[model samples]
Target: MATDFWASTHYKRWIVDRATLRQARADDLLYIDDPEHLAFLAIYFAEVVGKLGKKLRLPQRAIATATVFFRRFYLKNSYCETDPFIVIAACCYVAAKAEECPAHIKNVVSDARQIFCHEPYNIKHFPSDNSKLAEMEFYLVDDLECDLTVFHPYRTLLALCKSGNGSEDASAQEEEAGEVGAGIPADDGPRYWGTGQGQLELPPNGLQTAWFIVNDTYRSELCLLYPPHLIAIAALYLTCVFHPATHETVSAVLAASSSAPASSSASTTPDPPPRRSSRQAAERKKPAQDPLEFLAELNVSLPLIATIAQEIISMYTLWDRYKEDSGSVATPDSSRNGEDDGPVVTPALLTVVLMKMREARLLEIAHPSSGRPVAVNKMLERTQAAG
Candidate 1:
């Protein structure tokens, strides 16, 4: 397995541009009118994979790897060309082995069936034969080009946290100088980092919230569009934004720093420099650095981060409007029933779109004289055969 993500196939072969990703999905999009429908299906399947992973008792790493595999497969091929239910099972099986936490093929199939049998899915087409999953695993590996080693954002998030906390000595000095919480609103108390003293700390649930965000990224094309580290940074950024304490602390620090020069110049006669301890002197020169500051210092593309952030925000909007049984737009509350726990895209809807894709392929295959590109026709035939 490649420990360095930069040298791995994931970075070299898997990271794709948005245009390339969109072009790859052009064929599938023809069958499904709304592009957001693809996102809805992705989220629904990601959750399904998560549930199956839990049932199999696989670790988070394995589950994450499985979700990536499922997404990567779809990037190369459409749901119409393959049954996503079997693909989900295959991904779980393959990811387990790749992560060195293998699960039994039979157990994966059984667990997947149980999950598909429920509410929105009501899927009766899931293959009962464990061999089908095993067979699909071969196709999945081929589609993935055997790049089974997946580096996730979780490790990167942890590393960033540790590095952020390493600045505690400096942060403590700022706390002593009464500069740590300067300019912060009264309501924005130090809920996460402890009265703005010591190191930058995530709120009680900040790390978990970021982890969930990272998990949710798999539901979008982020895994394919950006590197794992960038995704980790984006997740951390969102975590800080969502948590008032962390967000305010960073904002206050930046706001204070930006206004420092103006405030110092406005004074007619500045007070003499105070005689103070070395710690205080150091604090005077360097204020407490929050996670946001740490993020800003990193050598990364801010635009890319902004783009990923926007993509995630867009996904949230799509998730809120997604419904299992309908293609029409509806609010989150309207989509849910009293009995249903959450919204899900039914297999029946997926089946309908997939059948259309297959029919189009069949028509293309029959009429070689049609204007459709020969390459597309052959590709469709190959996908149809693989299915």
Candidate 2:
């Protein structure tokens, strides 16, 4: 019944140290082949959700939270363990629930199946007549160890922006009255430290503001350590910086948006891109030169497709750390963000997280063949229910 992130079952298991996960990622053979592949899958998945989130006009935070969920799950598990489409929908479903978006399972699944079936990653091998979702859900739980609490960076950004407005005015009065230090924590206080040596810049604005917000939140371990608000700012900021041209517009819009009280846009967003265009997801996005390329464009790091390939190898490293810390082996560290919360580790949660992950050395493989009757519909149901 308690929901503290640190006290949650997730905190006990899913989080990992970044440096440690990196070592495994570097040394492991599976991830060595294609780390980019995996990272991009996350980016691609986020893009799909982003479009839908935007269409529905949901708060950027909700969509960002969902994307973070997708990324964390994959970071902890693998693609084949359960269908990615299902995983993505699950993230949205969970995010919707967490954010109190009220998304139903049937709608999420039916919409996701329809979108994926028509667009990129045109997966035709899904099961057509099974509660494939239950199986996959079990797998997801297994891999993630049932840990589901997720934090993001967006909340920090809002707080910073809101507080900054007040602090800025206060500081303005300080300058007029006579420069004097207020009750601010010099180290983690409300000072706008900039790139220069000692000069304080104006309160962060435009794209840079987003970056600072993200960076600070990331450092807090929110993604794995703190909360999604931290990461949301990062993603939003990164999006702005990379696409400065568009970011300029985004900043202006967001600035105005920030002024309004927080509200969840309840209207259903546009559908995900059709599955027929799966292969073409790379080509369809029109991107900016360099920065924009990596920031917004899904294929910004296409060459890193191997990251996805490395899931198998890097995963072990996570499992090893988890096994050492928790004195167990079935579940692994969900991220290197290092907040300390591990996966749920309950049989039910573990069953959902680890559904598709299997080493080549392991026996009993389903092989994801065509006409598999995937449990996509049911997956949607559970996702909504769980959320």
Candidate 3:
């Protein structure tokens, strides 16, 4: 795996522009008119990945990787071309290997059957044979171009928080020592967020909140459009905005930190530094830096971060309007089951669209003169039959 994202296949080949991503989905959009329908499906499947990963005892990193794989596969292929249930299982199986925590193929298929066989899906067509999942894994890898190394935002978020905390400690020490012009140099680049800017203090739940935001971004096309680090920063930016540090919040954070357990080796270590007087401590204390200002000073493209943030916000809006029970799209005013509101998209509606896509695909295969692009899996099957 490439350590640097700049040199990784994710940055080079997978980071698509918005217009290009839209164009890529044009074929699928022909069958499913409302693009939000697709977004809803993506969100639904992401949750499926999470649930299955949890059941398998897979790490969050592997779960995230599986979700990305599922999304990437659909970017190139239509939903009707292949069974999404099989793809979901295949993605999990492949991601486990990619993350060096492989799950048994039998276990993956069994768990996936349990998920898709109930509720809104009630999918009876799910393949019972383990070989079906094994076969789909080949197509999945082919679609991904063997680019299995996905860099998630979790690590980047932690790194950012760590650097911010380190900078705050250094700033306080420098203030106490009466150092002149003491801080990260301007030439230190984007690695450190506290360079020249004031110190950043994350709220008590800021990092945790940012983590959830990052997980949600996978539901949108932001993962395919922007780099992981930018998405992480955008998540952190949203966290700071949503959970700003008030006096009470800060006091709670201080209290929690003070009550944390000391290191086990503390008794063996020497710590004889003279305690600072309360007056001296008060003089060294500095006001927490505004996270927004700190982020603004970083050497990154603000416009890109803003765009990513907007995309995440849009995802949340879609999630709000989604209803898993309804099979068809409903108008806002249409009341169902005594409910005043209706969903914009539903699994039933997506199922109808997929059925149309499948019917169209059958017709195209029967009449090759239609000139529509054949799904890769179909072409492979045709080749095998010819042989």
Candidate 4:
């Protein structure tokens, strides 16, 4: 289950200093202030996640899952941790075997240098040294409290959107809308969000996750604080207003209504606010359920989740087309059903995998049919035939 960011090391040690957060305001990095950046990072690193998975030969789902974990962690905590660069790289390491995307520490470090390296910031400090990452790993584990599982809005949102024999109705739509980006309860006491909430605004994808965090909370079915749809809308509004998402993305959604359903509601709507990302960028946008929350089941299913964790391990290998030659499962899958078990591969999971890939620009969302069921490509070589 996805936990609060405040309780994370990100909240405690990593709040991005306000000065630093704004430092790029006057430079080329001004886009850092735009919300598109959040989408940008999630998309970008998702590629890294996939590449790492391939190099290590792990599953596509595991790679996508780890990327989401890294993105969510940064949303609440400022980027002021010992070395966020290190943490980002380390997260892939921690999420690897757990998510079943295994890689040698040496290889992980090597790839980190090759792909994610920024020109000025020496990549060496970013998880290359075993000693360094080991230290940060402990910090990450401590901050996250070994709570490494993350729930993604992709599948949750997709399920909510795709239910009912491939068509949706208003009531069903409302239910799907509630699946992601619910309202965030201010933490005055338990501070489940970690020590990072009161800190500066989150990182690029921080608010994106913020949108998810709030909504996932609502999906718990334990509260009436607000409807999940309301939370999704508001969170997207807030995220688009304040962070890397620009008015462009926000307005695009609004403008899109014209070509869409042409509901009476669309005609009465006001123009969205003027915000940042490239105007052309909005025109290129594709439809995604706002806040994209579809994994509401995690809120109340820890027992089932324990089993899913094991399944994640096998799937990671199945996708990578590389695994132990010995053919033993990295972690065993449930054998109780007298059924053939495979990685946790499903259409919903595939959507998240695809969303991450599209965001990373590795693949373009040209036509709806243009998209590939990449989840299968990476994992279908599930096993070799008997010798």
**Which pairs clash inside model 3?**
327-348, 327-349
Error (Å) of candidate 1 at residue 49 is 1.7
Model 1 weakest lDDT span, ten residues long: 176-185
Q: In lDDT terms, how accurate is model 4?
A: 0.39
* Superposed Cα deviation of residue 251, candidate 1 (Å): 2.7
Worst 10 residues of 4 by lDDT: 378-387
Between candidates 3 and 4, the TM-score winner: 3
Over 4 Å off in model 4, which ranges?
Answer: 1-54, 80-82, 117-124, 154-387
lDDT of each: 0.68, 0.42, 0.69, 0.39
Give per-candidate clash totals.
0, 91, 2, 39
Q: lDDT, candidate 1, residue 136?
A: 74
The reply for model 2, stretches above 4 Å from the true place, is 1-12, 19-35, 52-58, 126-131, 134-146, 163-387
* Residue pairs with backbone overlap in model 1: none
- Per-residue lDDT of model 4, residues 92-166, tens digit only: 778775654466788776776765454222233344456555555665565556655433333323322222222
Q: Compared with the true structure, what per-residue lDDT tens digits does model 2 show for residues 15-127?
A: 55666445433422232233433332333455567655554455555665566666556555445433566666666666665565646666665666656554333444434
**How do the candidates rank by lDDT, highest first?**
3, 1, 2, 4
lDDT of 1 by residue, 1-387 (tens): 456555678878889888888877787776665565676667777777888889999877788888989888878876654567777888889988887778988888788888876545656667777666766787789889998877777665554463333356435423322211122122422322233233336655566677778888887778888887788778888887876767777788888889999998899986777677865877769655667766666667768888788889888876764444534433222444444434444545554555566577556655756666445424333322432
TM-score of 1: 0.74
lDDT of 3 by residue, 249-343 (tens): 54555565565555543567675665678658867886545455667787688888888898888889878766666343433233544444344
| Cα distance off (Å), candidate 3, residue 126 | 1.2
RMSD of 4: 22.7
lDDT of 2: 0.42
Instruction: Report the alpha-carbon TM-score of model 3 versus the true structure.
Output: 0.75
